[model samples]
Target: MSVQIRNLQSEDVLTYSLPLLLGDVRPPLAESKISVCNRRNNTSMSWPVYNGTFKALVELKPGENIIELMFYGEVVELVLVYKVPPLTRFVRPVYIKCHDDPHGDFQGPEDEDCSAESACQRIALGAKLIQTLTAEKLAEHGFGRKTFLLETDLDAKAPACHVFTSSLSVACAQQMTGAELWLKFACELMSAKTFTQKENCKWFCFMSFTRYEAENDSLPKSHIDVLKQTKGYAALGGGGLALFSTGNLHCWAETLDQVPLRFTDTRKIDRSKFMDDSAYRGFYWANYSTGLGSSLHELGHTFDLAHTRTGIMARGFDDLYRVFIVRPLRSRASSCSRDSSRLTTPSPYSSRSRSRVASGNSIGAEPCFLRPLPTRLHSQPSFPDVIHIEVGFAQLPTKLTQCYTVHHYDGSETQTVVTRQSDGTETRSQLTLSPDGEWERKDVKINQLDAGKTGMQVTACRELPMAPSALPHSAVDGPDSVQEFVLQGQTPSDAGAHWHRSSAVILNYHKWFNEDCEKNQGSSPEITGGYITSPCGLRLIELRNHDNGTVVHHWEFLHDDPPTEFKVNLDKVKDVLPADCVECSVMVEDSRGNISKKKVHFDDL
Candidate 1:
């Protein structure tokens, strides 16, 4: 018997192909999922081909195979083509559901077989459905600093945490080795709670997982529930909160074909024949555990330690024992060449828990419940009332200390000032009080002090805490440390471009001008990298101390690169310089830089 098959003629097939066309890119009409159908019988077709081109394909029977192509959702374009194969291959109806984790309902079903010509239509529809679904999910979360997302290589069982101001999210799966490192360096080490007067810090966190785990693993549910219970952990850091509604976290999951974050690639760690493979696997396992340990060992880095051969906090460990025992060195010298005596000796004040602590001394836990406490929710109060006054300064022989009272209406004002100290104290400062000195008594009541109508600006007297008779002398100061670089201008009318200025921008500017630029207005500035799609056609001028403390240097205007001119813009640079000298510059290719100085003159606006 001879097998004879031929393309189904339009008359023989119920399904007829309609050309897919692009529509105006309206919000609702931007994309969609499509189902091919037969106009005569109004029956749907199954198994349409999906190609990115303007064409779609459907299978048809031996005779007429013409099918009407129907679309739902938004249409970004009208120039679509239908690429149907020869008739005789008609299959069952295709499911018309939105591409959801579990999928959602499409507009309708079709009776006609999917024409081979509908492949482009199918592909376009699938792509549009995916993008639509993903975008809708991302929008549910504000996608702001309060909520962050991370795409990581953490495995299904790995633990992850997202730190936010009002929200927190913990990953359900066990953590990957690098993810553990990120938790230590990004979460535990750099968190604001790890520092005193955390006002100087700002951070948001997120841990991502592979799609298979996010969808199938019950971890997000369990972990998010755990995070929901962790009020104690959340309260420790004002910005700490948890959320598990997956949008930003799961967007990538929808695109990937049910793969783990590292599914496409697995890290190949070089193992030695001299070492046991199980033991080597144990090394990774131990690292995962130790990472959890480091999360708990939140010790603020007050020590200037470095990586030594065999110390906790050292760079590499010989085996699992060292991974648990050693940590990253805090002191620059702590990890340097040393004998066994110097290797593991504890300080006089060292305790068991203190030995392995990270920089903040914060202890982390598996997201869990907290004992409900009747405490006030300390949220940001109304904008703080700031008062500026010239107070008397008493100079000591070694360092000068200034004391002044700023009356607070709500008594919620806080203070943090950098004091000049000896070496090893750059990261911290200690209040030096005499044994006989009154610590609490030193806090003056603003109401009791004599004052002007606005406030009291008193001549501060310097008295020795140790010896009252000793006169406090001031260091002969030269330059005004408080400097201001103003960036004030209207955002261009064409607001299509992205503009992001992080606090790091200020840090970069400090590096740009070095000490010559002095202090910026306020402790930090709000403005950062400036961007625009349309040119406003404006130039910037940099202002410096123009004194003995300042040395003018040549700079240039640059975009996405370091300046090559003799002047710089405080508002334009994307990054900060690493060093303090003008000649000591950031790489042109790298955003790290000594940010330049730019001031808004009365006319620049």
Candidate 2:
């Protein structure tokens, strides 16, 4: 029973102060377990070796780390050196608390620390998890494990609390939509002299004041469909910021050791105790992943990464724990395929009557009187521990080989592990998947809006009002909405292009831009049907379920080309729309940096 570190080029490695995801040796010994001891911290834990592989997150210390891998009886020692990246850019983990709210408490149960300080710690840890995931993914794509840095205090202590008091009353902020809150926070942080010294940086902002008003939440009478509305919270990423709420922060683990146990937790969520802002992903762990994973997805947006067909950039985030822990997402599958999608992370981890002490702190969270897990989860364990190894990592961006492959999608590709030549030396020619198998990722180039250019043009256009849209057809006629409308685009080569004729013409966009540009808006300008100086053309369009913040599809306009004359017509997308697309959002940015994000409901059509 033996498992060893398989991918690092050397036992002595230089790395970031993030979670070290150690993959098992290929054709692993037996399906047993291994003991990992971090000599620096004297923390040791047993990790299960599932299938032909096993993986675990080994925490590293700054400067130097001595990690011991004890397999059954044999022991292998590996040395790792940790260092903060020299890059100036970083992702700041922040918490936004409401003004005049003394408690500054986030949503959580009795034993949990829902205070602003606790929220900062949780935010910092969650930020590292996603940051580690990003690095592992980049390494998987053969990018040498590159990732952004995290901002720390002068003392270099982190999960550092960067608190901002909202000018809006606690009640007002609590009532604002995720978009509204995100916009407000982005505005405040950018203008803050204390926070803006860094010329270019991104943020993982957390809202500590959001809460669900269950009193007004009217779920249908059917007890089977008891999901609630997730207002006042958001899971969006774009521009240089990713925003979310602490409503579900309680589901996240406070310490690293608690991560694995948290992922496999099968307890039912008591809404009063644990806020399931994630709606259907009602388990304690699922909510943890939903909020954390969705936030990472949005952070990808801030990086200017567009959605790919798969990987974390898509919906492959459900099993981030699988990358480190040998546990399946304790989902309950029913005979009804119709409900299978809704049944992810379905029930309690086990049906066996275990003592209530299993829950050390969450009192009575898994009482038998409460609902049970899906009856269909194989009690005997017929599935391979690694079958769901991704959430299975066997996927990609067109190219693949025994080892490495490059992708055209902005340098994104599946990670390829190195194999040994007969001499025991490594060779890139012998590329292969990790002992745990594969991981995939792809993203489009994200670019910041040229707000300076936009400003100069806006100033010039202030005296010259933009012409009303010269669209062949108008798909917008109602409300003066910032996030409701359709968009149409065409290549200069395609003179006959129309929204209904080509997919390249219609989609959506939700973006983040400097608030400074917003103040210079043209007089009487409107984004939708009202007025426009210049149709800044389309740079990128994303199709997503805004409610959950899942980006469905992404379209990018390379070479910075955008259509000069476009239209908003939902009627054109009826036949060519993507599956399950009930609606689409569109944002039109004029020369003045004035952007109008609009939505078109297929139901209305």
Candidate 3:
């Protein structure tokens, strides 16, 4: 084979994100075509090498799987193991409708199907895609492919995304703010005994009847600006809930079969084909990247992940396609905007940022609301000449070992969480889930079972058969709120020199446009800037013109007890960046040698 696989070994074990093919190709043979065939499942996937890289979501079966990839007249065989994720807590995908529109039909371009059934399929596909991305990212971070699972429908044998009829009216909801929409869903879902009882469950919800409000143009004989028009109110996440608008559902692929083509699809998002207000959806494929990536950002909040200095938590999910596809089919990246995640807060773990914001924030008309990981194995002597080598079976990544307390029938209590230290902050060591596949969360509202039946992998946290005491009970019957389940995760063992990171952030940035002259945004007061926060302290932060690879701004922080986090401003980048530059990339490195790099399009400011 002229091209070698850079990210994977011959035989590997994968816990989640089944049927996935993610790796890089050796250069020179970069753009050549590669054909991937799964012998056991009789499945075929093909993607052209992209700039010395290749990534795709493929198909596979349980247990031992054989895959053959051929390129440049050479074939490479690979073997891997697929272990289903044993996560008990899951994010339930749901489609809600107003009483008047029970079918839950969403507004969209005529060419697209917006019916309830179609919506369910799209939702299921999107949820699975998210699951795959999460697992792949966790693996990339050396976390061993741990991720949350999605509820499954027994009858359909698919993702269990049910249709919910909300009591609110279309008119009432449209007039309500984003905060109202989120609260409604949280409260309504909580009304179910199952959801309220189980603190582990989270929800991903969308409404069916949010229509675009066409704004009238004031200029005589002038047409309305397509970008100015806004849609129904919805965009919030936190405390076991993630709610969003269905404006971009039309752009989502209905099944995994449609993703490969959808990744490379570049059809212009004209009003004739798309039901949207933000021009950021530059093309059809972008609809998938922005929607899915942004969804990951909102969902991150439900998992207790905070807004970081960069990546999905910020404004960088627009390139989510890069995670699935090495690069875009056509270069429309610069034409796109940061509205994909709709995060409006001053990002980069702002030390002063609000702690408990409910609705979160927004980008353009697209708002990304909030919210809000993982441990040390052993200590190594700081000697300069010592080397250690130990090989053994890899353990699964950190699970929510235990997060809350469970009161038994007798005078005994079981505190389900194991506490640990994470960068000076105390955190919970979670259940790493059940072997039989029943995991956490009572959100299903269906059946009940024990830890073994439900798949709750008992770690050190489960305190069973506690001796009964005659003294009066001292434990509280319940928690103050479901938010108590929102825990700060532990750092992975291998992540010793790195922070507790999830999904290696999506590469985020905030573009500052000059109001006086949109074309002259380069001269804006603040060229571009974002938030930065790290526990290990910062080593360096660099901003460069991606087109020419010229350094535009650079900073180095050297201190013992460094401030938690601070803002990053590139106000002087125009002095060094080429006037014609289209995009730039930001690279941040922590004191522990871990680095994060992401590219953004735009020049001048």
Best by TM-score: 2
What TM-scores do the predictions have? 0.17, 0.55, 0.52
Model 1 bad stretches (over 4 Å)? 1-206, 210-445, 448-482, 485-605
Ranking by lDDT: 2, 3, 1
Model 2: per-residue Cα lDDT over 38-135, one tens digit each: 89999886655655466666777776788888876778787777766444457788888777886577876655566877677778788777767655
Write one digit per residue (lDDT tens) for candidate 1, span 103-212. 21111113111222222222222222222222221222221111111111112121222222212222322232333323333454345352332222222222222112
TM-score for model 3? 0.52
Q: How well does candidate 3 score on lDDT at residue 435?
A: 29
Error of 1 at 133 (Å): 26
- Candidate 1's displacement at residue 64, Å, is 50
* Candidate models: Cα lDDT each: 0.22, 0.53, 0.52
Candidate 2 vs 3: which has more TM-score: 2
